[model samples]
Target: MQRALAASILIGAVCSVLSCYLVLKGWSLMGDAISHAVLPGIVLAAVLGLPFAVGAFAAGLACALLIGYLKENSRVKEDTVMGIVFSGMFGLGLVLFTKVETDQHLLHVLFGDMLGITPRDLIEVAIIAGGTLLIVLAKRRDLLLYCFDPQHARAIGLPLGVIHYGLLVLLALTIVASLKAVGIILVVAMLVAPGAIAYLLTDRFERMLVIAACVAIGASFFGTLISFHIDGATGPCIVLLQAFVFVLAFLFAPRRGVFALKRSNSHSAG
Candidate 1:
């Protein structure tokens, strides 16, 4: 239980930070693609007697790079390319999964078993989350500029390729780190929901980051608690809480929410 709580906190924090960039950049599908694309890597790693993280990271990075390459080299659109690559890889993973004999449970890989997290798993999450947070915080300005305006970022002397690929690498790493806690299917929610909720609440990037982190951490902690009492899956509980929060922010955010907008309009009419 302690390890589960600890893992949730770390995963929540790291995921929320990247979630801001993902929301700003409109890369929700990209997050989904990478998350799904790691399955084959996980399967192969099991067969090869390698760590799941090593295989998952390699596959995720490959997926990102492949999407980029296909989008640039061919006439196919980015979203289409992402759909193709992820679906294909996911299909391949399912096929391989059936053929391979491994101790890993399919449900756990797909949905995560947060309560089953071991001490080693907790340590891995901490290292990945801590390292990812450091790098992202250090390059927040560059990443922000890139997300807001790639052309402007280039005009201002930023290395567009490095920033672009660096963000992808970070995204991949984040997903890899999150696998044991949230699994592939739900990790996208972790990567998206907190930033989206924060986006609705704030106009500033820094504030967005803070709000996102708070939302994620709070959800993770409370969701884990809820799951324990209710005999629920921790990952889904965390994601469900995030979804609930998103709806709240959507309706009640001071500036951007539906109710807030309606209030402003009424005041304007008066």
Candidate 2:
């Protein structure tokens, strides 16, 4: 239980930071795609007796780069490319899962085995999450500029290509680190929800980061507790908790919630 909580917390913290960039840059679909795209890599890694992290990172980065290339070189929109790439990869993973005959439990891979996390898994999560957190925090301001104003960021002598692909690489590495705690499916939620909730509540980027971190940490801790009491899956519980918080933020956030919008509109008319 302790190990699981620690893993989830680390995963949540890193994902929360990236989720801000994802929300600001409108890269939510990219997050979803990379999350789904790693499954086949995990399967193949198992078959080849290799570390899952290597294969997962490679597959995720490949999918992300392919999406970028296609979007740049073709007429199709990025969302369309993302959908196609992720669906194809996920389908391939499903097919490989049936044929590979690994000892790995597919259910755990699809969902997660949070309570089953070992000390070694916790250590990996800590190292990856620690490094990722530091990088994301160190580059937060620049990355925010890149997301909100690419032209301005370029004007200031930022290397657009490096920033773009660096974010993708960081994203892939984070997903690789998170697979064991949240699995492919729930990682998407972890990468999206907290920042979205924070966006609804705050206009400032730095405040958004703090709010997102708080939301993610709260959800992970409470979700783990909820899952333990109810005998439910921890990943789903965490996602559900985040989703619930998002709904609350959507309905009640001071500036942007539905009620606030309605009141503002009425006041303007008056």
Residue range 104-156, candidate 1, lDDT tens digits:
66568788989999989889888888899999999999999999999999998
Clashing pairs in 1: none
Query: Which digits, one per residue and each the tens of the lDDT, describe model 2 over residues 1-270?
Result: 888878878888999999999999999999999999988998998888887888888899999999999999999988999999999999998899898887766667678778988888788778878898999999988999999999999999998999999999999999988888888888999999999999999999999999999999899988998999999989999999999999999999999999999999999999
Q: Candidate 2: global Cα-lDDT?
A: 0.91
- Give the lDDT of residue 267 in candidate 1: 100
- RMSD (CA, angstroms), candidate 2: 1.0
RMSD to the true structure for each prediction, in A, is 1.0, 1.0
